[model samples]
Target: MLTLTDSAMSKSVSISNIRLYQFIREKCKIAVVEKNQATDDPSIFTQPKEKWVTMIVNNSFLLNLFIEDIDFKETCREEQEKLEKEKKRLDNNSVKKRPKCQQNYITSKTNHDNCHYHGAFVYDMNNHCKLTREQAQTMTQNVKLIASNSASGRSMELPKLIWDCCLGLYGIDPPCQVGSCGLPNEMKGQAIKPGQDLMTLVQNLFMNNQAAEKRTKDFS
Candidate 1:
């Protein structure tokens, strides 16, 4: 009888390595040709993850079924709760007061000419139509990056949109890269080039071939 040796494992066969598919393949091993039995290679990216629930007896395979984004609505609700809680916490505090005139919604409705000016306040403070600390804090509640529709059950999520920017805001790189945000190495110049946008250049992102050549020349 011809028998395979343990030390010659490389010469022996590995009919199938999939734990899930092992039984079916083993049953077929009785009929499969020797050369065809051990050549199936599994892909790392495409393999199934091992799944099971602990029970008293031997572990058994589960009939896994596919489902859509089950946790999306739950995740949205959680984030919304977090955002509202943060807003509520900041509602009452030593907030800087804003002038009543600046708090008015309409410029056309306000009598800007004679008495009701935009800057007059109860404490004789001037206002600039800016939100108070409390108001600013509360603004975050309504001003969410994720829209309310994002929580709707029927909504489909497109692949997340990612854009390279000098600053992080609204989950997208903000176009406001000048003045005080510590501008990136690229696009920080006084003026943008013709046909070039502000986001085109970035520091350390370009090749340093010339600098390397100079370094090599100096070292030699």
Candidate 2:
């Protein structure tokens, strides 16, 4: 998600950026496919053990994650006990609330004055007091409710190994000092016009190729 401003580096462009363009144009779907794969395991046989472990630890940590920790057993026991207590509490609450919820629903069904709307019993006109089976079905269809924790369906735009691919080596940072991806810290925020059109041009070229193939087939 590199965001460039409205012509920030119009004068000078980074060679690394140009290399990125070349990668997209030449490698076909490598960037896109690798990007998708990297979402779950970015390193994926590429990164060193230390780097991979560091990345994993940074993202998550269990109470007894490290065996080297002094109180590893104690930490594990404590976490287990806490988890049990939380589970018990949830179960007890569910058992206590079930009868109450059922009772309330039964009470509300007979009386149209108040009814549950979005988990709350409301008297507002916007919240219907009571609905026929058909009305309930119709309302449910019209309302566009999103999941509370919806998963992202979109894949990442670029591969995590953009630098590695360009340089034909692993673990090299972007803009390697040896002129790998293009340069080492070449005006960090340069406005790159040629690189900017990389995606658009690649897509256009692909579409044009497909069109030409279809035309050839029709004539044949």
Candidate 3:
């Protein structure tokens, strides 16, 4: 009977090393190193260095799956440190160069123009039209119905019409009270672009509504 030598049979392999090799073989591709004139030896009988020794990790997701939790956490900690350093550097650089409006939104002093004007107009209109709470709710439902129905084709002209109907005011030139209530012109020309037409304004209103709906859904 032939017997194996202790040098060959008694050698031990680490579990971590075995797992790493298995992971690389299962989740990554192995490639042979490209032959270069300086390193390539045609007369050498041995296999190329990269043929059995190199791993090419093309699938990042699979590679991540095989990584140890401890290693992954360490990498994330390092990355977060780097990001914090970068943010500190940027904040210092921007302290003197930041625009006036850059930090205004975070400040306590809000413009409040939209809130004040829009609220005032709505309150006055409720008083002028003698709209009860139930009536206001009904008008809200009607507006939502029109918005839902007008989501396709050339239905951009429906918001103003729905508003007009809800307020019981409709015509080529509506009543002065209806006009003063801020329907169709909420800002009273405060922020209107010089060349913007009615169609553009209506389109913008719908876009704002769509954005608001998306935010609501996201939060929900």
Most lDDT-accurate candidate:
3
| Residue 125 lDDT in candidate 2 | 24
Q: What is the TM-score of each candidate against the true structure?
A: 0.14, 0.13, 0.15
Off by over 4 Å in 1: 1-74, 101-220
TM-score of 1: 0.14
Evaluated against the true structure, the overall lDDT of model 3 is 0.37
The worst-scoring run of ten residues by lDDT in candidate 3 lies at 115-124
Clashing pairs in 1: 186-203
Expressed as tens digits, the lDDT of each residue in 139-158 for candidate 2 is 44443232222365443322
Better candidate number, 1 or 3, judged by TM-score:
3
What overall lDDT goes with each candidate model?
0.30, 0.31, 0.37
Q: Candidate 3 lDDT, tens digit per residue, 28-88?
A: 3433343434546768564434344333555454445445432322234456899998887
TM-score, model 3 to reference: 0.15
Best by TM-score: 3
Q: What is the Cα-based lDDT of residue 60 in candidate 3?
A: 55
